[model samples]
Target: MVRRVMVDEEGVEMRVRINDMKEMVKEAVGNSGSSQESLEGLVKFILSR
Candidate 1:
């Protein structure tokens, strides 16, 4: 399972890794993207887990 926690960043800022994953998914859904299959595999893994 994914564990998410909030941490004080000295007022700098913070972000979730899922945002990066979504960006990767967007690229995968693009034309002829190499990550297209990878995105599917990741989704399966997450669901199975």
Candidate 2:
């Protein structure tokens, strides 16, 4: 896998994959993201205990 990516000078597929992953990470951490909501829920539950 590493050798294949290194040989591809253009890095087209890798670039696209990296970009998509970045977008997904951004969305997961956004204000109204699922990850944010889960964290908030966990905090509330802990406080209620």
Candidate 3:
């Protein structure tokens, strides 16, 4: 997951972006990342059986 979703933005804008962190984390856990990809693969393996 990205550490900073935005850089050099207004506080309001940054705060607004911060609100999406939950969704971002969900996506990351959904295998939208390398680390999560490995975990997801494991989950798939189990589900495949």
Q: Give candidate 1 misplaced runs (Cα > 4 Å).
A: 1-15, 35-49
The C-alpha RMSD in Å for every predicted model, in order, reads 10.2, 2.5, 8.1
- Could you give candidate 3's per-residue lDDT for residues 1-49 as a string of tens digits? 1334444346557777777986787777775676698888899999999
* Candidate 1 lDDT tens digits, 22-43: 7887887886677777777789
Which is the winner by lDDT between candidate 1 and candidate 3? 3
Best by the lDDT measure: 2
lDDT of each: 0.65, 0.87, 0.72
TM-score of each: 0.36, 0.76, 0.35
Pairs of colliding residues, candidate 1: none
Please tell me which model should have the higher TM-score, number 2 or number 3. 2
Ranking by lDDT: 2, 3, 1
Tens-digit per-residue lDDT, 1-49, candidate 2: 6766666755768878989999999999999898999999999999999
**lDDT value, residue 41 of candidate 3:** 88
Ranked by TM-score from best down, the candidates are: 2, 1, 3
Error of 2 at 34 (Å): 1.1
